[model samples]
Target: MAPNDSAQTTEEAKDLVAGRRRATRYIVPVAVAGVAAATIGLVPALAASGDPDLPKITAQELIEKMAASDTQQLSGTVKINTDLGIPSLGGLAELGGGSLAPGGERGESGSAASPDGKLLELASGSHTLRVAADGPDKQKVSILEDTAEYSVIHNSGEVWAYDSASNEAFHAKDDGSGTGPGKEREAAPKDLPTTPKELADEALKAADETTSVTVGGTAQVAGRDAYQLVIKPKQSGSTVGSIKIAVDAKNGVPLKFTLTPSSGGKAAIDAGFTKVDFSKPAASTFDFTPPKGAKVTEADELEKEKGLERGAKNHEDFKGMEDFQGLNIIGEGWTSIAKIEMPGGEGIGAPKDGEVPPEAEKFLNALGDQVDGKFGSGTVFKTRLVNALMTDDGKVYVGAVTKDALVKAANEGK
Candidate 1:
């Protein structure tokens, strides 16, 4: 995105918006900004130091500066921390039938990245990411772990996601989908937020009626002087308290992004760089060669192998729920709730059939609490910023709003 003062820049901004919509499905949209209706996963970052000395700038100006930023080459270390307040992260993997991990479908043994893996890894705790970019077509993001690394590389229109521990890789061709690694994000697990800009882009997507934007002040992020652009929701019922994007004072690039929950203690999601470099990374940084023993899975092969497993999905793995009917959006803007129908039985119970495993059943029982409302009784999963209500009839309502909001949406169908 660039300065919308000119026609060229306006077009670029629209393009950026469209490009971003295509590139992402995650970090847990949490009924926030219409990112997802099923579940919201917030990506957190390390906190920045106190405010810094900088020239005064308005919120609109900072947004413009960030949109106009054109940093095409850079390398940096990004720290991702998320605490959605949900317990038993390993239960999430079992819910997915062990398909959640990036490339470790090989067996049910070993650490496997996470019990807990790939997308699950980004859902909580702290992760160190090595990121680099040279122009729109070349870039790399690597998640460094104790004994393994997961990486996503885009070079000359080819995309590769490799998991070192699993010794497996996923490969795809860009096909001119869109600029930024997110264009094909839904297809691969590593398409998560690796930079402040990526997470900040989500906040920018808020509808005008739902957002109130302002300049929070100045700060130093990754040693760079930056301006904080704060966005808050206008309506009631949203789980998000506010979003703060730290924009580099000089380059206009976003240096950090944090989303504080309305119930607020600590930020539910905080993401930013601890170290950064604007200079281009060496060409070798994007060059990737699969290890000899690595199993390479092509994009098409992966898609066919795993249906709906490519992205974070609702709990439809329960027995007798064959197809995920679809989603219904209730209300609008920040207060909106996402309604989806699950075709199975009254409750997420031990399946009479083997469609779901024992662990998944156990997870479902533990993750939610039994509750009854005007709409009826099912279960509810509550976190700092989002609430979910699964009705007895198999209707699921998710939103950043309160549990009452979800129940209201279920009853009124509004």
Candidate 2:
């Protein structure tokens, strides 16, 4: 190959890798939230240690056990391993990814390394979290990063989030009623999902659809015996091969979770507890006083300064599916492709000048292969589990399905 051609190929290879990261960060949280995040080549031997002999339980019984779990107080160390299978954006995180790739109509700004993009930071790589909850009113989660710590604590009506790297803290006061938009906004992403119980809840909800549920046997988790709840989609369109949640044999709390993609060699997601305690964490665990030098921001004050209505602005955010026009679910069950309209009737549009931004072009080119069909030409972002088709016609058809499945869904919609 020519030198220029070789160099161009190398750049495309990098873009492909980074674009996959962006896609997984942007899509998996929404698409595979119930199944698992877009896991790539992380855990080569992530399968359970060994299958232990345990009393057999029916799928319904296992479901009931998980649903009936009422352990409201506990603390644990959660280890999360995942790979988005895309290249790292390197510096393109500021390409307005926080809000746009997140599938939001609202605009928000942040660079990839900034703490403001904490939630987006969960998109790739491995993560370790310290999570504790005392019933519903008192909860705390600390994301332990390499050089920084991101902690959020909710004690009664006060919610405090502190980012050690940035030396900034944010506070929000809840209604104490533990419900409504305030509650939703506080716990939605701020908690940063630290336990298998969290994903297990979503998986069980998927079971409500056309899925098969069974017990895959028992295994050891956090030094406790756990029954593996195996869930598989009954349709071929879904890219998810199978889901396994290990439930505490005695209490039913999900102790470990794994998701195997349809094209899997090893499991994509392998999250489990390294240590756990059922005892209520000390009162100090939920208490927070911003460090001496940390700059603090109050949610209410910010809303007031911006002249934004709490009820209205927050309601729009949660009403994403309803407010995001042209979004439709094509097909049924786990194979469903959520069709979301590209913002501004453009494919990651640039300014009003009518030109594709260079960064945006690179982002798309790196994300996936180009395809042409009755649905027209578009980019297909592929991972182990989820595939998203960003059509030339300002629409995105995404789901845990194959590239062909996305095309078919787009065509069927057309």
Candidate 3:
């Protein structure tokens, strides 16, 4: 082979390997996130023995009241538990740690590394989250781990994150101009979706189309009267059977969220406050000074460098790939499908004859079942609550829905 041809082949091989790794990074999180965020063990309130016949209300009224209810100030200890039903994949724990890629950490922006995102990434395990909120602009979330704690605090025009495990702290200043550390980090605070109200709102965004809401019954959550609002997907192909949320009757705050898969079984994800107080916490709860001798880093510089690197890579790899820039949502709500086109028809690396590189093929095969579809041949990765289909044509369709849902999406798109 000519020298130039040999170099091109070598580059293609490297790209192919990198592409498979990226795909693995992308699919693993999506599949796990489906269950990790919504499926948790029943909280103390819901687990209390004895079913008292609490007043029943229409789902519509409950939703309306919840919308009007206010829970701006409060303190609580939330418990998060998840069971994906698959054997322990050591990599699963890394999901909660941050980036899916090996050694990849999220940007330093307070918003990018939000507490909610971190909590959701945790693998199948039990965790405690302590939250205190004085108002929208003043709030703190601390993840309590064995012998260590990870805390994120947003207060007085500044954002601070400290990880006790490494004794590292990150700081960013919010100048109130929408360009501050927090705003730049998250782009939208609401995107974090940690609160009961926030989670309900997120699910409701896809109501009527992809899911139907109904009041399951009344229950006690966190020693308070609460109503169970059940959200069931309308799509027959979805793997999710329903999501049950216990909303505080007095204040409309969601006290607990539980998700069960379509295949009859126990809850896959359960999260809620085991202890809560409606009163405002002390002013010191939201304050942090970054213990002396702790290594502190300014997020602004880190984010700037990351942004530059991302921009350069995007320009280099996707200069003419305008069609792949946006994502298309095939459906809405719980069963919704997110379709993204790969830059090259064959994805990151396209061998001359359309054969997947041996290494890439081996990697994918180990992760999930390989299936053939009407659109083309691809692999289907499945978990108890989520499924994903990656086609040879460089298209990916994923959802917390069933494998049939993904296949249906792939067929329809074709």
Instruction: Compute each candidate's TM-score over C-alphas.
Output: 0.69, 0.71, 0.72
How well does candidate 3 score on lDDT at residue 179?
Answer: 42
Order the candidate numbers by lDDT, best to worst.
Answer: 3, 2, 1
Please give the clash total of every predicted structure, in order. Answer: 9, 7, 7
- Considering every candidate listed, which one attains the maximal TM-score? 3
Residue-level lDDT tens digits of model 2 in 1-414 = 466798889988899999998888876567766444335332423544556667988666776677667798999999887665644432344455433343111233211222345655565568898999998789998899889888888887888888787787878787745555446744765577634455556766666668988888888888788899888888887888899999998888999999888887777777889789999899899989988977787776654643453467767666654545766777788898888875455734222323668786776587678888887787888887778888877788889898889989878777
In order, candidate lDDTs are 0.73, 0.74, 0.75
Which regions of candidate 2 are displaced past 4 Å?
A: 1-50, 89-92, 97-116, 178-209, 305-325, 341-354, 357-363
Q: After superposition, how far is residue 145 of candidate 1 from its true place, in Å?
A: 0.3
What TM-score does prediction 1 earn? 0.69
lDDT of 3 by residue, 131-234 (tens): 99976678898889899888989887788988887787878886763245446544554666545455556656657676788998887777888899998888
Better of 2 and 3 by TM-score: 3
Please list the residue runs of candidate 1 whose C-alpha ends up more than 4 Å from where it truly belongs after superposition. 1-50, 88-91, 98-104, 107-117, 177-207, 301-325, 342-366
